[model samples]
Target: MTLYARYSELLDTVLDTLQADGTLPDGIERRAVAVEPPRDPAHGDLATNAAMVLAKQARTNPRALAEAIAPGLEALPDVSSVEIAGPGFINLRLTDDAWRGELATILREGDSYGRSDAGGNERVNIEYVSANPTGPLHLGHCRGAVVGDALARVLEAAGFRVTKEYYVNDAGGQVDTLARSVHLRYREALGADIGEIPEGMYPGDYLVPIGTSLAAEFGDEYAEAPESEWLELFRTRAVAAMLDFIRHDLATLGIHHDVFASEAALQAEGAVDAGLERLRSKGLIYEGVLEAPKGQTPEDWEPVELTLFKSTEFGDDQDRPMKKSDGSWTYFGSDAAYHLRKAESADHLVNIWGADHAGTVKRVQSAVKALTDGRVDLDVKLVQMVRLFRAGEPVKMSKRGGTFVTLADMVEEVGKDVVRFIMLTRRADAPLDFDFAKVVEASKDNPVFYVQYAHARVRSLVRKAADAGVSLDAPADLSLLDAEELALVKLAAQYPRTVESAAMAHEPHRIAFYLYDLAAAFHALWNRGNDDPGRRFLVDDNPELSRARLELALGIGQIIRSGLDLMGVEAAEEMR
Candidate 1:
């Protein structure tokens, strides 16, 4: 168990004892009491607000309660001293043996050091990077992909059964556009002189290969077919080809979704109709005309009575239309059915979308609530834009020319690990600037490089110890570790708490930040050894101390490796 968990258990024991002795009231809720590290390490190694929180309920003075609990806390095996501070805060200083035992646990658990059962095996579905099947993925989709994939890994490490998912928007008009573009390429491949692509058509060269495949398969068979006879056939072929291209691009970043729910399939199976019927029974579905949007009404806007969902009843700003004027289901209707299908089996649903979709968040959440009768929880995380830069200059974009930088282009420029790490350097809702020159630099400014370098430095130390005939596998006398050395171990011991908090908050960026802090702590300790030879890991006259310091270094490395694994990053044994 982690030192923090041990301390928490001890605090619980103290509270139980106090209650049994009739000094505190019975049935006091202990869930809000937290035992954690002090914000200022100068105070103590650990601090708790148990007395402050429970005193009010127990009808006693907080300081008196803290004073009453101090003796019992100081008597605990691991605690060296306990002090009552301002108000009712209790500060604890643990023994050297406590730090040593944590290091031993790290060496024993290895890569599983931070694994926890905080999630309790609940099933979670994470949907992200559901980019349209029209072309290769672009810079906009990259952040959500990395964030979702890393969150899945983190949740799984916290013992949650996670399913990575993607929603294929093949029923949209974009696939038809893709089919027409492929047909243009098909005609060009057959010796027809098709000039520059007409306006409103996809002009990307990625479609050339799909066209070539079509030409080879049926040599002009589709050349003379009517639009009705060939539209569905071409749409099917184009969507499949685009999905293949997308899968390959995702593979480059080490992302593979466990499920690909198709919007077209949901529509064809009448799931949308069934879902609407269910909402209709709840009086959430009705035919109504919506008022013009307040801020920017369309120039040709006209009132039309259409099928609408009572989204306002469930916290949306207004009732949302479910059908278009042409009697076809709107995109919102399709999405509602898709979420209903998702809520059927998963205990929790999470969708990672771009920030531009912020306006749609409320309506979809409302739809899911109506569909599930509030039985399921849905969380939508909006990832902000990512701007690309090279040498501090913004990368250009040309929407008319279809010349945005694709995900494939970025992956080819930097390695997959670098791309994944840099994409998560900021929170999902914050805009990130991915500078080509800065991310690849081997300096403290680059987080991934700094963290990896720390792990490699520890590995280098182990190699040096082994070269001098030191046995790292043997147990060490951990009491030889002084304040600076023990401080490093304390930072390493926070891994379990970090993992649990990050998983519960659905924030994978926390893991990245924690790893960087750990690396900084390790680097600081290594620098300290430069002026003080006695503090160094290699001591000529004291091999026992040297072996113990090596164990501390190895334990630090184990934690770094475990944290990196959660982020799906590879820990380097040596820097290039």
Candidate 2:
């Protein structure tokens, strides 16, 4: 059993014994009893407020309960001391052997040391990068993609059955515009000038390659065909190429979606019609004129009666139109069906959207409630904008043609590891300033380098041990590890708990910060060795102690690797 598990069990015995002795009531809730490291590390190793929490319920003073509980805990197997602090805060000091116990557990479990079943085997579908297929994904999509992918991996690590999905917006007028753009590109491919890309045509040079490929296939035939005969054909090929490009872009970041759900396909079998009919049966679908939108209502505001859904019933600000006056399905209509399809497949749906889509949150949430009859929850995580920098100046990237930065460009410039890590350095809702020059720096200010250096030091120690002819077989003579090394081990062991909490909160940046702390702990211990010779990891003459220290180093190295793996960062073995 883990040291934490044993500690929890011993604490339980104390609580139960206290209840039996009438120091506290028997029917108190035990869920809030959390044993975690104290905010001020000097106070103790671990702290809990069990007595304080139960005081109100038991109608007794917390200090009295903690005093009664302390003796029961002090008698346990690994107990060093149990002290009742201010207002019944129980601070427990474990035997040095308990610290040794943490190191031993790390050596035994390695990468899986911090793994937990905290997710309760629930299924979650994380949908992200639902960007339009109009063009290649710009820099903005990159942040959401990394955040969502990392969160999905974290949830999986925490034992949730996670499905990483991408919703394709293939049915909209945007695709039609893309088709027309490709048609223009088709004409240009057949040796036409195309004349300044026209007013509305997509002007990206990337489409030149698609047009060239299409020309090679059709050989001037599509250029001569009418819009009706060639629109669908070019649209299909163009979207496929766009999707292929997007897929390759995601692959560069080590992200792969388990499902690529098509919004158009949801309407192939009249599913949208059937879904709206269902809403109609439930009295949600109605014909009404929407109140003019605030601030920007047109002067020609004719109250045209259109079919609407009473989204306000499910907490939306106003009723929404599912179909426009032309009887074409609106964007929200397809989204509602898509969410319904998602509800049919997964236990829950989570969407990662950009800040611009923030206002759409309530309507989509309301639609999901109406579609599922409040059976499924649609949680939308709004990721704010990301600004880029290079050489300490802003790197301006416009969304227009020839001005934008592709996800590939950023990844190519600084590499995927640096790109992914920097993107996750801030919370999704917060703005991130990513400076390429600052990220690759080798100093302590660069968190990426600092964290990787911690791992490399461990690797160096492991190499030194092998060179010194020490056997790594014995489960790490952890008793030789001092206070600093023990603290590092304990911090590393909290990774699984950190990931569980981060995933539960829809926050991937937490893992980024956790790595920083873990790295800081390792750095602190490394710096300690400089001031104290006995604390150094290598002792050439004392081979036994050297082996145990090597084991601790290897344990730290393993944690660095595991943590880096989760964040999709590279764990550098040696920083040259």
Candidate 3:
């Protein structure tokens, strides 16, 4: 167990003892009590607000309650001291043996050091990068892909049964455009002069190979077929090819999905109609005319009666229409059916979308709530825009002009590790600037390089110890470690808590930030040796001390590796 968890368990034991002795009231809810790292390290190793939380309920003075609880915590085996501070907070300083035991646990657990059961084996479905099956994935789709994939890994480490999912929007009008583009290419391949891909058709050269494959399969067979006869055939082939291209792009960035749910297949199976009927049976669906949107009204806007869902009853700003004026199902209708199908099996649903879809979140959430009857919970994370730069100048990319930077392009320019790590330097809701010049620099400004450098430095230390014949089999004399060394261990000890918190919050960026902090701590210790020879890991006259220090270094390396694995990043053994 992590030291923080151990301390929390001790605090709980104290609370139980207080209640049993009648000093505290029985059945006092302890859920709000938190044992966490103190805001100021000078205060203590850990701090708790148990006294403040229970004082009112127990009908006692806050500081007096803290004073009463302090003795019980101070008497615990692992706690070295406990002090009651301002406003009923209790600060704790743990024994050196406690930090040593945590290091031993780290060496024993290795890559599984931070794994936890906080999720309690709940099933979570994460759906992301559901881009339209039109062309190659562009910069717009990159952040959500990386964020969703990393969050899945984080939740898995926190003991959730996670399913990584991708939704294929193949039933949309964009796919029809893809089919037409492919047909144009097919005609061009058959010696027909299909002029400059007329406006509104995909013009990326990535489709040239698909056109060649089509020509090879049926010589002029589809070249002459009318629109009705060839639309479905071309649509099927185009979507399949685009999905393969998308899969390859995702592979380059080290992303894989367990399920790829198809909107077209759901619509084909009458799932949308059945879902609507279920809502209709519950009187949640009605035919109504919606008011004009509040902002600038479209010139073509006109009131029309359509099938609407009673989304406003569930906190949406207004009732949402489920069908278009032409009587065809809308995108929200298809997504509602898709979510209903997902909610049937999963206890939790998470969708990662771009910020452009922010306005649709409430209606989609309302739809899921109505469909599932509050049985399953849904969370939608919106990833903001990413602007790519080389040096300081902006990299202009556009999918319409066929000049957009694709995911494959970025991965090729920089390595997959660089792409993944830099994408997570900021939170999902914050705009990120990926500068080619800065991310590759060997400086602290480049988080990936800084963290990887720390890992590589530890590996180098281990090799030096091995070369000097330092025996690692001996148990470490952790008591010899001073304040600086213990500070490093304290930072490493926060890994499990960070994992649990990041997983619960559905934010994978926290793991990235934690790893960077750990790397900084490790680097600080390494740099300290330069000024004080005794602080160095290698000592000519004291092999025992050298071995102990090496053990500490190895434990830190283990944490870096574990945290990197959670982010789907590689821990480098050597820097290039």
Clashes of each: 0, 0, 0
As for candidate 3, its clashing pairs are none
Put down candidate 2 lDDT per residue, 540-563, tens digits, no spaces. 578788787788778778877887
Candidate 1's displacement at residue 413, Å, is 1.9
Cα distance off (Å), candidate 2, residue 489? 2.3
Q: Candidate 2 vs candidate 3: which has greater TM-score?
A: 3
As a whole number from 0 to 100, the lDDT of residue 355 in candidate 1 is 100
Cα lDDT tens digits, model 1, 1-576, are 567777889888988899999988999988889989899999999999999998999999999999988988999998899999999999999888888898999999887888888889999999999999998899889899999999999999888999899999999888888888889888888878889999988998998998889998878987767777777888899999999999999999999999998999999999999999999999889999999878999899889999999999999999998889998889999999999999998889999999999999999999999999998889999999999899999999885688899888889998888989988899999999999999999999999899999999989998888888888666788988898899999899999989888888899999999999999999988887799988788776789999999999899899988888888788899998
Counting only residues 3 or more apart in sequence or on different chains, how many pairs clash (N, Cα, C under 3 Å) in candidate 3?
Answer: 0
Alpha-carbon shift of residue 13 in model 1 (angstroms): 1.7
lDDT of 3 by residue, 336-448 (tens): 99999999889999999999999999999999999999989899999999998999999987777899899999899888999899888899999999998898899998999
- Model 3 misplaced regions, further than 4 Å: 295-299
| TM-score for each of the candidates | 0.97, 0.93, 0.98
Q: What is the lDDT of residue 501 in candidate 2?
A: 78
